[model samples]
Target chain A: MNLVLLFPILIPFATAVACLLAWKQRHVQRVLSITGAVLLQASGFLLLVSVWQSGIRAVQMGNWPAPFGITLVSDLFSAIMIVMAGLTGVTVLVYSLADMDTGRESFGYHPLMHILLMGVCGAFITGDVFNLYVWFEVMLIASFVLLGLGGEKAQLEGTVKYVTLNLMSSALFLAAVGIMYGAVGTLNMADLARHMGTVKQPGLVTTLATLFLLAFGIKAAIFPLFFWLPASYPTPPAPIAAIFAGLLTKVGIYALIRVFTLLFVQDLEYTHALLLVLAGLTMISGILGALVQNELRRILSFVLVSHIGFMIMGLGIFTHLAITASVFYIVHDVIVKTGLFLVGGVVRAERGTYEMSSLGGLYSSNPWLSALFLLPALSVGGIPPLSGFWGKLVLVKAGMETGQYLIVATALIVALLSLLVMMKMWADAFWRDSPGSAAGGSVVSANPVSFESRLVLFCPIGVLGLLTLAAGIFAEPVLTVCSRAADQLLNTEEYIRAVLGGIP
Target chain B: MEVVMSFVIGGLYASGLYLMMRRNILKLVLGIALLSHAANLLIFTMGRLTRGHPPLIPPGEVRVLESIADPLPEALILTAIVIGFGVQAFAIVLIRRCFETLGTDDLDEMRSTDRAP
Candidate 1:
């Protein structure tokens, strides 16, 4: 049963290798990518079911025993993340067949993408801290190449900033891991959590926790460390941007949640309090940044940063209910956020540019695209009456119960403010006629979009939109999984027993 | 000895950060290299400096008795060093390409991607 935990990681690794073998054949690579994604998605669901049935599953790789060896484990949280990664992985891989250019495709785009997928799966399931670091490097190297693949002017510019900042974070992450190992003598997360309270150095753990927060905060695009996000995310094409937008920061947030709930809980008063403050600031700053952007992708990028705060808000509150809400927020945000970016691509496909000033009459010309765009814009950013509402609602309720009314109020106000930004987007992009095409002529100045590409773009949006609605309308099942995942997180003994084995 | 190495590590980090803050892309890449080197050394020092013990154990023993120098951090640093080398290599090539295309080595002019569109 523990072997089932390896399937998510292995499938993508195998798929990526296959893609590399067919490097010269884009057609074969595309077919292989989709098949691999489907297999990955299937494996994710299987792993989730296995975890559901068996509680927590762990497998140790190579020769060492559990604590000293590299272990792969799946609890509810890891399984759910794998499943979500698979979902977006499939949609974006399918969407890329239409969206990515031939110039980019010739340069091993499919193989790098699968490697990225494998890295993500590896990050989600790894049970050791150093192993997690290695997986992160995998994701980073692939993303670095992907971000700079086409070597366009804007892309190179974006890649420079993106590379420098993320490398800083990676260095800090390494230092923190080293310090933790020095202090604890183990890199296994379960062992670290078990031994964290007994460290001889009095204030070292707090400092290490702060170091982790900084490292992951940069990755997750929290408040001060987030400029690289808006700087780079807009440079990539829609499908690439969508995958990065949907999945990348969430990995950082996942690490933050994992480390805080498990390894850093001893100093909650200092660490978690700081987290709460940062969450509020991230919410305010991100949306405020969005309000000034005229570009469709740029606006969506800022909104992505803003809503990342809501997920952190759940983690900051640090209660079972709050954690459950955070997990649900992650699921909702991943589906909705990826959909929003893909829709931005569609809007660009319809018009000539991503600039809202140049884009208009989309609703009148192509109402289907307009409606699909609305599904995500109106859904997340804590907007009411949609998939995003349940997460925020529970978050606010949890915050109120915890007597953290300031952050809760900030959360509520940010919700309304984000709604205002989304409305402004709708008015600017869909409601107004183009400045020149006000007389109802379509403003598709770019090359005529092919039917296959159109299908490629809209299908992902439709599927994500449906998933968003289903997550909203059928909130019970998702919420149950989230709540149980939260329970497993807050209570790590089962995880410890699974990974370390034969212990209380 | 640990204290002296700590200062050395601190100095490396300081210079690394100083270089990273420079406008020249070359300097920035150099800074990244310095920073990664500092991190690797920090890991090396933190693993506790025991000279020439050579983590090998005698055949009769089940384990290296009396606490042989921990070998894990060396392995960790090896991995980090390789990853860092790859990243720095990519960064150097990227700088060349950026210079060829963007026509500037200064980080300030690279703000076209960040400008309000």
Candidate 2:
């Protein structure tokens, strides 16, 4: 009943309402939105400290006990997810303010931004399955509006496919929930875990499990179901694109981990094997797509898909160590990927396009920006002393311990290819001279030395990049937390007892 | 009666999948709507068939009557239908917008923009 647990959701929701009421005054809306983001970050930090000191916290809405009432629970994993969501929300807000056009901002972008954050945070913290579905819809609806906010030809066309695919996925998600509830007689995740233990319908369970996987798979942009992502993601403005690239897919992964670990562990032999095969294919195919792409953003989108395999690989291995590594990787990938996309935005801004062939020579003109971009890029490539390296190391170790030889090999090879693709981007964008260097073509340099503009974009990135270093350097403590989270997930009785007051 | 309901459900699913595979934008919307209906019905059927009993309990009874229909799945189906309707409405609007911008309802025409040209 600690009120702090509610702020991460409430602050943004309240701010969104406030922004909508004051929508005519763009400056006031901006102030409210930015202040809301900062407040969310502060509250998230406080919640994290509380969760670390205490055990998991469960808040049953309306005080109707769990298994009966809707609940919002925050375990260590969820707390970490909330904090990451807040950090990303703030970073994207700052970037959007600095980068978006005034006309676009006036079209309720600020309010929508706050609402989107509210949905994301709520999804991360909610304890009930049906509530998770509702949050997914809330988040998707906002994203649908945001994706088409620009109303360009490409944006409109891409939004069609994006909306269609996601809508189907959403329908499937509801169907899955229906089936689960019908089978287990409860929508509460904790209750379902208990009741599911007594169910004898293996065939029906597998079907429902597969349905859930497909629904989440599409959202996460896994290999077979990922076509919609690269198509729609590149069409949005950079801030929108960056946040989507970083945060949205991870929601699918989060749901996957939560459902698979908590509800479907009895059938892991089947599901984990399926996940392993999917991970291998996802890694190889995603990188191959990246390798062939010429456009900067498109290539990054494919690479983003490829990196998802690494996280899923950690889950497939299903060890304490492996799950921990997956958690660490998820946090690292979100920050690094978002930073890279923001850097991509900067690149596009300066060059007037996202095509690598049409742009170059940024390193000399803006060394600081280049450095900021380079750190995350290298980190994502799994260079030492960066966050990416530690995550990969843990996954590889877990893979070998599980004797999953092929998965281990695939992970290493994918890591190499990721580095190659990133290096190619670096060479093409920063190292080479501009295409019209001899002609001295008019390049739209948006104040190359503007400290305030650069600070607005780079500070969030700097904080994330520092986190990358810290995660790598201080892997032990983070791993310990992940282990506890994993243990809690695998041990169903603890969750049930905590929620249902000593279990039914 | 159960066999007939299952056939109806299967027919809906088949038609939905067929429409979804089509290139026409309007058909895609129809496909989603049909598929959602089929799924909701399938979930409803999973509760098993009950006969000769209403969903409500008698006023004096402390527990539900025997052979009563499972009301939980019906409640779930109702919620899902409302959600599906909202999503479908939003999709229809988006499709209309797409048609306005691209000047074609054909998926083939939309492909050139999403893929590398």
Candidate 3:
């Protein structure tokens, strides 16, 4: 058992415990959180590098044999996901330093954030279906506390809806797990993957698959199951919102991809076709929702929901190229969405409101912020010379090759609509005259944003924007990594061997 | 015994879903609690019924010789129950706080976050 496989999960958990112990010392907790984030990034890189070199790695906890003991496994997909989680963790924590007030920090924000990261990492790495459930709960509980940290009336209202829906999701997830165990008599994911074809009742397997679809569909905010997301996501503080926008839903997508590709591919014609329908609906509904929203965060939240359809579309296609496109899209979406939300926070910080109707003149006053916003905004809209464009291009190309012209058309139209909405935001928030100010009030250059906060905030935004640009300009490496991960996913026997020690 | 347990589980799930559909927050919590219990029972039933024998394999033996019940589902149910309890407790406390602050337990009145003014 390699020790490195455990570090990505352990460091954040240890850091969370340390931060909790030092709760009274906010500065110490801040330093500890940042240090812990860096450590997490380093360890994630190490694991990624190792897994990239080696095919896949599995560690059986307590030395128990596989198919019996809880196993932590890392393939290229899981490792790359870990690395991305670490990246988001570092950026969001750094952003939180300036964006979050002392009120929330003293109330245990840093520790809960770390715990949340730990849970996300655990979910990415675990090899057991039941263990993934446990990690989901871990993420849920910590996220609950973080969401309602200051307990504002709006936050609490949002938290109630969030927690309610998520709890129902958990119950559904538990039910699926139980039924799966009864059907297969095992809880290990690799074991289940190997045994999926041989199950006595194929109908039972399909039922379990649908149960998982329901469970994860809610979490991923797909189509009809997405109302809880827009209701709650915009109520939290911006840094918290940014991280949630970045990681939470993607975790659900990760689970869906893992299972559908690895274990639940028995009846692809039925399951994948259902996913394609949901993908179209999700994309349409999400874009329409974004089009109507005037609030910057709300618009971005809907955009987040819409982009999930792109990844799901990839999954529905279920080809090697499609899965590769999905992985690339997931990477691009996580970075760009987080960056967009962070910029939204900056707008709110500068203007004291998220409603675009109340704000204006940002372009004349703060061209740099406008530029930062435009990078991710255009990227998310799938403009060329950005990371998001490549992901979309690959998915569309895959769709065309497979003769799924309708989905391809839907994707392109959604991309265009997304561009329109983003440009509308740009016009309203940056270019238009301030609502309260006179027509030519010179952009309200009163400097409401503090110098220190701007410096701290801009650092992460600039870094992430550059990373997005890098991912686009240097697409070959990222595409290589994604294709490798996709290849591993399509070939599940290697994973079963890695976990089960090649007994077959 | 198995048939009786199935009926009980079915009844719990029915009542649970009914309670969950209520607009009252307290009833919502009760519904969640009931549904969780039903889920636990459903898992319990899936393992089949064995009387007067535990799943213990004894001190020296590597496997149980007796036809004991499958223990994994029970273990899973136990974990699910603990998680359910935590979530339910949090839900109750949150509801109490919401009631005290907003002066309403009806889910309909809690649309402040959902509706746009």
Candidate 4:
């Protein structure tokens, strides 16, 4: 069980080292990455079982105990995150194998992918705030390399903006950490939660909380801080873009949830009200951006920002049910959003462009591709009997319970807008007719024998689609675990005792 | 001493914020550096300046403590300094590449490629 906690981190780190050593051998790197991702998925599942059985477990490094040393803790929340990350890691690795250009493969793309996975896993499991910062940097650096791997004109241009904005966020994060350390005298989250309770200065704590919120909010692509996401996410290759869209921003949300619930619950009225306003504005603005965009990938990227507001809204209400709903929504969004982006990638690869204005009739020429996209699209739009519907239902129920009428109303409106956006994508990309439809029809006829590429592409999307369905069908068990995870987060005494050996 | 350090940190942070808002990429990188330095100094000062103490007790002395300078803040500052150096290095390289490829450092000029022609 303990070893399971370490595998997600270690497997990727080992594979990253191997990939770097064999940098010149593209095939070797690909094979190794795929194998590592599979192993990581297995390990993640095993860790989930252990977490379910034993409750939250903590592993201290160098045997130095908790507050003074780095610790990796795995509760149900972190365990579930690892599994999702692993699943996405494998899907993206396979997609990249088929989708990445041969010339670009020679330039360490697989290595960076593995390193990014390492950072993702590390961030989920880390119990210390400083270690969280370290993992964030690790992930950002790898993303910077991956974003610029092709060195194309647009890639370079996007990389500059991405890197600059992320660097500023990182600076803010460091500044927050410094302030936190100065105030609390410890960096361990559990320890800080205890110390924060003792601090008498409300102004200082609120200031620090705001600083942390700004930093993580930028990463999470929440309102007013989401300008960089739509600008830069579309410039990367589809596989890279898909994973980033799926996972990276959620890391910030994860931190936000952890900090607000465990450490800063003293001022929930103020913080929750602020988050409510931000979430409302983010939802409206993001969907408007999506509606106005004609490009397929950029529209999807903006939709990602809008959907993020749903999760934030859930957290703002700050109920047990609401947090659970937020957790469920995040997991559902990660799978459905990434699957949609990969489908977009497939469309681009076939049509040689992502412009909705220039693409059409894919449904007639490639019914399987069209069908493949329909499941995730409908799921993301919160259709019933899908995972997305369950999350939205939970959140809406929680909102009504809490009497947050305005937030509930805004959420319903956004959900409708989301459906419209997905339908717009489906209509333009798959249903409408264009001048190149005739040429596309003939090209598919000529390529009647390339089932391997199609299989390779569809397998990952199929797995994700199935999981989305299964998660919806089996919402009972997943929700149970989420409820427990939320309970643990809200009950800070258990976490403190697990880390620091009983309250003084 | 505390007042002087506080002023220094404030000045650095103000300049850093100004630079960070500039259009030039190099200026942004420098701004991050200045901001980090200010943050580190602020953390150092928050430990509360105490003279004539080194945070170490003499060998086998039974509770002979004389208000040492807070060692934890020093350790935090060291770690923060190292992390800042790595991020700054990465930013410098990124800025150089941006200047070379974009042929301009002005952020406003880098318009969206997908904008309707």
Candidate 5:
């Protein structure tokens, strides 16, 4: 009877429908979008608080009993994720006020954004695997429209690769779900988790696990399956790109963690070992790719891929501490990466380009912007008293405690390399003069941002930066929550009982 | 009958994969459509074919009186088919837009974003 779980999802969906209805009226759409975003954030907070007090909450849609109907379950992990997602939705929607043009808005940008949020929240809170696939499609369709809305040549090109690859992943995902249903005759994740142990054919289950890995791996942008990310992420507007950077691939990682930990743990050694190898390669390839990129967003995109490696590394280690670290890192990364991408938006606004070579002297020109950028930049590089540093410290410690010295060393090296990439971006975009500017070419914008314009853009980045700092300084409470979340995820019996009500 | 359905599904999958790997955008869309059908068929076959019994229980009955076809797979396939239709329609429109905007259907040439100065 805990109807609070439905609000975070339904509010956004209702907002999206309202936005579409008011599509001809820009102000009305904006009001609905903002109101929806605020409501979503509010309900998300409520969900998290309730879940924090109560162990886990489950709601059967239409009052249908579990295993026979759609179930929405919220544990600490999902509740926290939904709250973080709500935060991203609110901040990015606000930022979009500055970043998105009326052309895009008139073309249904607000509705699509709300729909995207709905899909993201739905994925986080869903208790069924097939429901997750449906949510994935919801997200995919919205993202496709968002990416290609501008219809710029670059956007179209990027959308093609992005759409094609993502659709293929969807097909793979659907195929896997079909096979899984055929095998177990159940779609509820908790029930499947309970049934997997007695499924009689462990090998088929293992094969299905690998199939899911490949499917979610592509979504999460793991190595060898991540080419579509760098090719597409940089093509959209700043707000769109920032939200994508913040949430889309992470949704894939979330799916990976859920399925691997819940339904596929019977063959942990095999799957996790495979995860460890991919993590090392994802870290290495991503940083190396970033080292060579010159565009700020492109470089950030590569680093984004690399950071996914660290999260996966924790999952690979698979201890209570490691899972806790991964959860913390996910929260930290979502905030910092979104902040970094907003900084990218600022850079794009200040100098009409993402090319670091074409940009320079931002530090001197706008020290406030530089300060905003530096916090997340340095934090992402694992500087102490910054959020990324704490996540990295816990992950590396988890690695060491597990006697994974090579991965520990690789994690350390990746941290250093990440710092190097961040500094390179700083040196090129903020400190050094733009190469074109140095040559007296047209590097700076002709029309400088107005005070009002600056306020619109600066608020989101400043809030995100402050949050990052706060998370770092007040790391203890967040860690306790994360550790408890990890414990709940590992304790599947609790989840199954919560969902099924002892029916089994 | 099971073997025949299996071959049909396998053939559809092979053709779908071949078409997806093509350089043309239109073929890619067709490939996706083919794959969706294959997936639906696979689900149907996996649910096990039954002669003509619907999974309906008689009115006012607490349970089904006799063995019947599994209704779950049909429900799943129906949903998948609808979703697949939407995705395929979107894909076609996207390719058309890409072609109109970028003036190319060859996947190899859709590299405007990937290019360097």
Candidate 6:
């Protein structure tokens, strides 16, 4: 077993423990957390380099062979997600240092943050379906506490919705795993894929596919299941929301992509077609909902839900270019959504409100903030020459090739609406004159903000913003990596061979 | 055995979803617990039911001599139970805290986070 695969998960776990040990010293915890985050990023990049150079990497626990023992595997797709997780970890941790109140900080925020990161990285790397559920639970438990850490009424309220819905999804996911295990007599993903077709009941695979879809669908926040996200996301602090927005749902999409491409390929016509229909409805419902939201985070959350459809569309198309585009979209959305949330944090810090009605004059009072917000806002909203556009462009190309022009056209229309809505936000929040102190909403930043505090708060937003810009401008290289990752996904023999000794 | 377990699982799920639909938050948590238990049992039943043969290996034997109960489902169930216990315990405490803070048991009343001011 190559120990290199363990580094991404280990760094966060170690940092979390260190943070716990230095619990009383907030400064020490802060430094340890940042170092851990940076190390996580470095390790992820290192793994990506190795995977890119070699093929997929897999390791069995305790030197046990594949089918019986647990497997931790990373292909190009998983490695790229790890890199995104690490990047979001560093950015959100830095942002939290400034954005979080002392009450939450003193109450073990840093350790929980690292723990959440560890769980996310685990979900990305685990090759067993059951382990994925465990990782999701780890993430859920940590996030439950983090969401309700301060125990404020709104936080508790939001946590209730988040926790209940997520727990239900976990139950469904566990049940699916159990059934799949029973049907196939294996839990290793590669082995399951190998044996998925041989189940005695003819329709069992498709039924289980639907079960998996429903389970992951809730997590991914597709149309009907997305109500929890907007309700809960805006209730949390911006940094926490940033982390959740950037990574959590993307994990679900990753699972969907993983299983649909590998384990559930027997009935692509039914499952993939269903996915395409859901993608269209999801894109429409989510953006239309966003069109009416009055708060910054609420709007962004809706936008987040809508773009999930775009990724699902890629999976639905099930082509090399489409999956590549989907991967690129995931990469792009993670950074943009996180950055936009941090922008919300900064806006709240400066203007003391998230309600769009009361926000204005940011174009003059804080040009940097406006610029930072505009970069991600436009990127996610799919302006030309941006990261979002390249992903969308390739997705349209795939849709055209597959002759699924209706969904392609729907995607294009939704992209336009998203752009219009984002631009409306920019105009309402930054361009229009401030409604002044009288019209301000009740919610305000709990963190103390001063001119000097700008550096800490802006650091993550700036990093994420610049990353969005650079990822857009350098789309060629990233697209190459994504296409390779997509190829690995579509051709599962490579992944299976890496995990289960020899190819079956 | 599968027939009996099927009824049992169905009953648990039906009641769990029923409780989950109620307005009370405590019942909601209880429903979640019931739902997870049902899932655990489903896994147990699916692993196949064997009466007396335990998945034990005689000393130095390469493998089990009989078609023993598959230990994999039990192991998976144990892990799920532990995780479910942790989650449910935390959830109960959180619900209690919610009751204390909000001074209400109704889930609908806690709509401040859902609705924009």
Model 6, A255: alpha-carbon shift in Å? 0.6
The lowest-lDDT stretch of 10 consecutive residues in candidate 1 chain A is A436-445
Best by DockQ: 1
The residue-level lDDT of candidate 5 at A78 comes to 93
Fnat (0 to 1) per candidate: 0.84, 0.47, 0.55, 0.40, 0.69, 0.69
User: What is candidate 2's lDDT per residue for A1-504, written digit by digit as tens?
Assistant: 578778978999999999999978988988898899999989888888888788777788889888778888877788888888888888988887778888778898988888888888888888889889988988898899899997889898888889888977887887788778767878888888777777778677767778888899899888799988888888889999988998888999999988888887777888888888898999999999999888888899999999999989988899988998888899899889998998888787766788888877888777877888888888889998888998899999999999999999999999999999999998888887877674687555644536677677777777777777787788788778777877777776777776777654
Candidate with more favorable, higher DockQ: 2 or 5: 5
TM-score of chain B of 2: 0.88
lDDT (10s digit) by residue, model 4, range A1-504: 368778989999999899889888888988998999998889899988998888888888777777989888878888888988898999988988778887777888887888899998999998999889889988988888898887776777777778777877877887788778878888898899989977777678888888888898988989999877888888989999988988888898888888888888878878878888898889889998999898998999889999999989888999999999999998999999889889988888787788888888888878988887888888878998889999999999999999999989988898899999999989988987755655564333322425787789888988888888988999998899888888887788878887776547
Compose the digit string of candidate 1's lDDT tens values, residues A1-504. Answer: 466788888888888899889889989988998999999999999999988887988888985688878989888999999999999899998888888889888888888888888899899999999999999999999999999998889999999999999999999999999999889988999999999998998999999999999999999999889989999999888888998999988999999999999899998899999999999999999989998998888888898999999999989999999999999999999999999998888777667689878877777877888889888878875555578989899999999999999999999988988899998999888888877676656465586778787888889899999888888889999999999999999998888998889854
- Candidate 4 chain A lowest-lDDT run of ten: A441-450
TM-score, predicted candidate 4 vs. hidden true structure: 0.94
How many residue pairs in model 3 have overlapping backbones?
0
lDDT of each: 0.90, 0.85, 0.90, 0.85, 0.91, 0.91
TM-score of each: 0.98, 0.95, 0.97, 0.94, 0.98, 0.97
Clashing pairs in 2: none
Each model's iRMS: 1.0, 2.0, 1.4, 2.4, 1.5, 1.3
What digit string (tens of lDDT, one per residue) describes model 6 on residues A414-469? 99999998999999998876766346743343455776678988888889988888
How would the candidate models be sorted by lDDT, starting from the highest?
A: 6, 5, 3, 1, 4, 2
Residue B66 in model 5: shift from native, Å?
Answer: 1.8
**How far out, in Å, is residue A300 in model 1?**
0.9
Candidate 3 local lDDT, A362-401, one digit each (tens):
8887899989998998998888879989999999999999
Tell me the spans in candidate 4 whose CA falls farther than 4 Å from its real position: A438-449, B49-67, B113-117
Tell me the tens digit of each residue's lDDT in model 5 across A1-504: 687999978998999999989989999998889899989989999999999998889999989999889999999999988988888888898988877899999999999999999999999899999999999989989999999898898888888889888887988898899889888989999999989877777599999999999999999999889988999999999999999999888899999989988899988889999999999999999999999988899999999999999999999999999999999999999999999999999888888889877788888888999999999999989998988999999999999998999999999999999999999999989999767767777555745778888898999899999988999999999999999999999999999999999795
DockQ of each candidate relative to the true complex: 0.81, 0.53, 0.66, 0.46, 0.70, 0.74
Clashes of 1: 0
DockQ, cand. 2 = 0.53
